[model samples]
Target: MIAHGSLILVLLFTSPLMEAFSQPTKVVTLVMFKWEIKEEARLLERRMLYLHETLDVR
Candidate 1:
């Protein structure tokens, strides 16, 4: 009975730590996704500027 109680206690303590560790990985992924979106927007802006400059040359 004592061992069962200790096991439950260990599980309760570890669950939050497990959740904390998992949360950062999701946050990192979201940050990386946002960075990628920003990079894509920058690339599109540059392309539009380049197109306008070329059109003006003609």
Candidate 2:
């Protein structure tokens, strides 16, 4: 019975630590995704500008 109680306590303590460790990975992934989106937008804007210049030249 004592071992079981201690095991439960250990699990409770570690669960929060595990969640804390996982949070940073999630944050990094979200940050990376945002950066990718921003880069894509920049590329699209550049392409549009190039197209506009070509049309203007013609």
Top lDDT prediction, candidate number: 2
**Stretches of model 1 off by over 4 angstroms after superposition:** 1-7
lDDT for each residue of candidate 1 in 1-58, tens digit (9 for 90 to 100): 5698899999999999999999999999999999999999999999999999989854
Alpha carbon lDDT at 12, candidate 2: 99
Give, for candidate 1, the lowest lDDT window spanning 10 residues. 49-58
- What C-alpha lDDT do the candidate models reach, one value each? 0.95, 0.96
Segments of candidate 2 deviating more than 4 angstroms: 1-7
Residue 49's lDDT within candidate 2 is: 97
In candidate 2, list every pair of residues with a backbone clash.
none
lDDT of 1 at 8: 94
